[model samples]
Target chain A: MTRRASMAASLVGFGVSVAAIFLLPSVLELFTLINATIYVSMAILALSLALIWGYGGILCFGQAAFFGLGGYTYAVAAINFGDSTWAVVLAMVVPALFAALLGYFMFWGRIGDVYLGVITLTMTLIFFKLFNATAGDAYKIGKAALGGFNGIPSTPPLNLPWDVGSPLAPEDIWYIAASLLVLLYFGSRWLLRTSFGRVVVSIRENERRSELLGYDVRRYKLGIFTIGGAMAGISGILFANCVFVSPTMFSLFYSAQVIIWVTVGGIGTLLGPIIGAIALQMIVAKLGTLEVIDPNVVLGSILLLFVLLVPKGLLPLMQSGFDRLRRPKAPVPVEPAIRPTATPAARRPEPVSAPVGSAPATNTLGGS
Target chain B: MDLAVVVLLQVIAAVASLVLISIGLAVIFGMMRVINLAHGEFIMLGAYAVIYATRWGVNLWVAMLVVAPIVVGLIGVVVERTVIRFLYGRMIDTMLATWGLSLLLIGAATMIFGNVTAGVSAPLGGVTIGEYQTSLYELVIVAIVTAVVLALMAVLRFTQAGLIARATMQNPAMAASLGIDTSKVYAVTFGAGAALSGLAGALISPLSGVVPTMGVAYVAKAFITVISGGAAIITGTLSASTLLGSLNTLATFVATPVIGEVTLLFAAIVLLRILPQGITGKFFRRAL
Candidate 1:
C-alpha cells in the first residue's frame, strides 16, 4: 500500500473506533461506563509512555510521578477554587512544568539511558514516600487535607467548561475520556508524521550521528519527555475524576505496569500501547472477579511470555504476519519501494546494542 | 561519647547494608553490563529461603548463611540459562526482561506466602550504649559485610577463575579466541551475584521481615550504589556505599526516615549530575 493510502485507511479506522466508543453508553450499563472511563484513562497513560519510550528512545520509569502530581494538583486546586475547570488546567500545567524541569536536568546532564530509568524510578519513590508521610493536619493545602496514604478523597469531578456547579455524569465522563483518547491517539499519529517527529525518531536511531548532523539531541529529548509528562498529566486528570487520586498512583507498581502496557502493545507504534492498555486492563478486571487464583501470577506470567516469546509485542507480530501474507502475491518490483517506506510506520526500534543473535563486539564493562 | 558510638554503629550498619545489597548488582551490571532489574527479587528469594528453612527446623544461622545463597544462586543459574544468556550485551532488553522476571517472582512468592509480612526475629539480644540500646545483629551485619568484601577481593585478585571472568567481561571475543568459555564465565558470574544478593537478603531478613514486594525497596538502593560506584566493581561498590550510606544514616539521625530516603535520592541525582560516570568512574578509575 502507498503511504497516502495507508494514512487514509488508518484515519477512517480511527474515526470508526472513536464513534463506536462515543456511542458505547447506549449498549452498556452506567456502572460499566464508569469502569470504562478508568480503562480509557489508563489507555491514555499507556499512550503517553509509548510516545516517549517507544518513539524517542528514552525509557522513563517514573512516568507515574508526573501522573500522581497531576492528580494531586487537580484535587488540591479543585478544593481551593471550588471549581473543577481551573483545577484541570492546573493539573496539566503542574506536571508539564515538573517534567520540563526534570527533563532539562536529565538530558542536559548527559545521563545515560540506564541511569535515566533509575533516576526517574527513584524520583517516583521519593514522591510516593513524600506524599505517604504527609498525614498530619499541617499537610493541608487550603481547604483540602493532603490525606497522606489515604489520598485526597471526594475530589471534585470534572465540571463543564462554562459552568462550575454542573459536573458531568459518569456516562458523560466516559464520553469525554473516550474522546480524549481518540484525539490524543490521532494527535500523536499526526505529530509522528511531522518534521519534529522524524528528527526525534532519527535521534533515537543514532544520537551521536544526529549530533554530527547539527541537531540538538538534548533539546529534542527534553521536548519529547516533557510532552510525555503532559500527556500523563492529562491521563491523571481523567483518572482523578473517575477514582480519587492517591499515593498509590505514584507507586512503583503503576510505573512498572505502564512499561508492561507499552511493551505488550508493541513499542514504536501509536496504536499498540492504547490497545495493550485496554486489553490488559480488561483481563485484569476479569481476573479480579475470580477469587480462586492470584491475579499477579497471571499478569506476571503473561508479561514474561510477552517478553520472552513475543519480544516485539502483539502489534509487531500481527503486522509481520500480515506482511508475510501479502508479500508473496505482490509483484517483485514494487516490493522494494513499498518495504522501505512501510517499515518506519510499523518498525520496531532497533535494539540499542548490536542485533540479536550476534555476539556484541564492544567491551561490555566500558562506558554504557 | 556513648551517643557518638551509637551513631557510629548505625552508620556502619547502613554502609554495610548498602554494600551487601549492591555487591551482586556490581558484578552483574558493572562487569557484565546486563541491567538485572530483578536483583532485588533475587535478594527476596534468599530471604524467603531462610524463612522456609527455619520453619523446616533448620537453624537461623545455617538458613541465612548456607541455604539462602545456595537456593538463590541455583535460581540465578537457571535464569541465566533460560532468559539472560540470550540477552547478553543488550542492556535495555535485559532490563525489560529482568523487570518481567521480578514481577513474576513477586507474584509467585505472593501465591505461595500470601500478602502478609512474615519474619524471623533477630537471634542476638540487644546491647546498651550509654543511654541507648540497639540490636546486636547490627554488629553481626557489619562483621559479615566486612568478611564478604574481603573474601570477594581475595577471590577476584588471586583466583584463576576470577582472571577468566574479568577477561570474558572485558573482551568476550578475545577470551573466546583464547579458548575460554565466555558463556560459562557469564553464568558463574551471574550466579555469584545472585548468591551475594541472597546473602544480603538473608542478613537483613531478621531486621525488616520478608515480603514478596520487599524487593522494590532494595532494588533502587542497590542500583544507585552500583551506578554511583562506577565500573570498578569492588572499589566502586564499597566507596559509593560508604558515601551514600553514611550520608543517609546522618540524615536519618537528623530528621526522619522519609526525609533520609528523599535525601539519599536527591544526593544520587546531584552526584550523577556532577559525576555522570559515577564516583569511582572519576576518582578510583584504576581501582579494582
Candidate 2:
C-alpha cells in the first residue's frame, strides 16, 4: 500500500479500536470486560517490546524490569501523594529514566546484541530479587510498604483525571485501556514512518553500517529503548489499576513470556505482537479452565510450532495467505520506506509484512 | 585451621558445581553460538532420568553416570534435527525456540512425574574435615567434575572428532569444502553439550531433588557463567565458574542466599560491562 493509503487505513483502525472500548462492554459480561481490559494493557506491553526488539534491534529480556518498576513506582507514588495523576506520570518517567541509565551503560559499552540479552535478563532478576526481598515494615517506600511477596494489596486504583473520588470501575478502565491501545498502535505506526524510526530500523539491520553512515547508532538505540520503556511503564500503570502490583511483575516468567508473545505473534510487526499478546493471553486463560491440558504445554507447543514452521509468526502467515487469495502475483515482501518514492523499492532486509502499514519490519533479522 | 579447611572445601565444591552446570552450555555456545535456552530443561531431564532409573531398580551410580546423559543426549539430537537446524544462524530466534522447548519439556515432565519429587538420595556417609564434618558426596562431586574436565580436555585435544568439530565451528563453509560433514558435526556437538548438561543435572539431583521447574534456576546461572567465560570454551568456562562460584559461595557465607545469588548476577553485569566479549574474549585469547 502507498503511504497515503496506509495512513488512511491506520485512521480506520484507530477509529474501530476507539469504538470497541465503549461498544464491547455493552455486549460482554463484567468478568469478560475486566479480562479484556487486562488484555489491552498486556497488548500495550507487547507493543513496547515490539518497538525495541523488532525495530530498535535491542532484544531486552528484562522488559518486565520497567514494567514492574512502573507498577511499583505508581503504587508508591499513588499512596504517598494520595493522588493517581502524578503517580501515572511518575510511572512512565521513572522507568524511562531507568531504561536511559541502563541503555547508556549498555550502548556506550559497545555490548553485543546477545550480551544485551544477558544484561537485560540480569536486570529483571535484580528487580525481582529486590522487590521480593521487600517483606518487612522497614521495606516501606514512602507510606506504601513494598509488602514483599504479598505485593501491595492496598495499591490504589486509577481515579478520574479531574475527579479524584471517582475510581474507575473495571468497565471504565477497559475504555481507557482500549483507547490507549489504539492510540499507541497509531503512534507506533507514525513513529515507524518517520525518519527517526527509519534510522532505528537501519540500526537494527546494520548498526555498524548505520553508524558509518553518520547516524549515531547508540543515540537512536537509547531513544527507542527509553520510549519502549515508557510505553511498558504505561502498561504497568494500567495493570496496577486493574490488579494489585506484585514482584511477579518482574519475574523471569513474565520476562520470557513477553518475548514468546512477540515471537509467536511475529517479531518485526507491531500489529502482529499486539494481536499475539491478546490472543495468547486469552488462549492461556481459557486453557487455565481446562483440567486435562496444561497452559504451558499448549503455549510451548504453539511457540515451538511457530518457530519451526511459521518462524515469522501467525500474522505474517495469515497475511500472506490473504495476499495469495487476493492476487495471483507472488507476494512482494515489504520494502524499506526510507527512500519513499525515490527508490523503486529495494528488497526489505527481512521477508515479512502485514499489508496494513508494512513499515520496514524486515523479518530476516540478524546482525551478522 | 580445621574450620578454614572446611570453608575452603565448601568453596571448591561450589566452584566445581558451577563448572559442571555451565560447561555444557559453554561448549554449545562457544562452539555453535546457539544460546540453548532449553539447557536448563536439559538438566532437569537428566535429573528425572536418574529418578526414574533408580525407581526402576537401576543402581544409583549407573543412573547418574550413564542413563541420564544417554537419554538426554538422544533427545538433544532429535531436537537439533527437528528444531535447531532451522534456526542455526538466527541467535534470537534460537533463544526463543529453545525457550519454547524448555517450557515444553517442563510441561511434559509435569505430566509424567507430577510437579515435584525426591529423587535418588546421595550415597556415602559424611567425611570428617578436622573438627568439621561435611557430606562425603561433596568430595565425590569434586572428583567426578575433575574427571569430567580431564576427559573433556583429552577428547578436545587428542581426537580427530575434536579437530573436525573445531574446524566446522571456525569456518563451516570452508569445512564443508574440505569434505567435512558439518551438519553431522553440529548434531554430535549439540548432543555432547546436552549430554554434559544431563550429567550435571544427575550429579546435583541427590542434593537438590527433582522438579520440572528446577531447570529455571540452573539456566540463568549457566548463561551467566558461560558468557562471563567468553570465547575459549574450556579455559573460559573454568575461569568464569571459579570466579563466579567462589564469589557466590563466599557471599552466601557472608550474607543471605538471596544476596549471594544477586551478587553473582550483579558481578556478571559488571563483568560484561567491562568485557563485553566476556573474560576469555579479553584475556586468555590463545588458551582454548
In order, the interface RMSDs are 3.7, 4.0
Off by over 4 Å in 2: A329-368
Clashing pairs in 2: A350-A363, A350-A364
Each candidate structure's TM-score, on Cα atoms with residue i matched to residue i, is 0.94, 0.93
Instruction: Report the interface RMSD that candidate 1 achieves against the true structure, in angstroms.
Output: 3.7
Candidate 1 stretches greater than 4 Å from native: A330-368
lDDT (Cα, 0-100) at A202 in candidate 2: 78
Considering summed lDDT, which 10 consecutive residues are worst modelled in model 1 chain A?
A: A359-368
Q: What does candidate 2's lDDT look like per residue over B172-267, in tens digits?
A: 999999999999999999999999999999999999968999999899889989998998999999999889888888898899878888888999
What does TM-score give for chain A of every model?
Answer: 0.89, 0.89
DockQ, all candidates in order: 0.48, 0.54
lDDT at A231, model 2:
96
- The local distance difference test score of model 2 is 0.85
lDDT of each: 0.83, 0.85
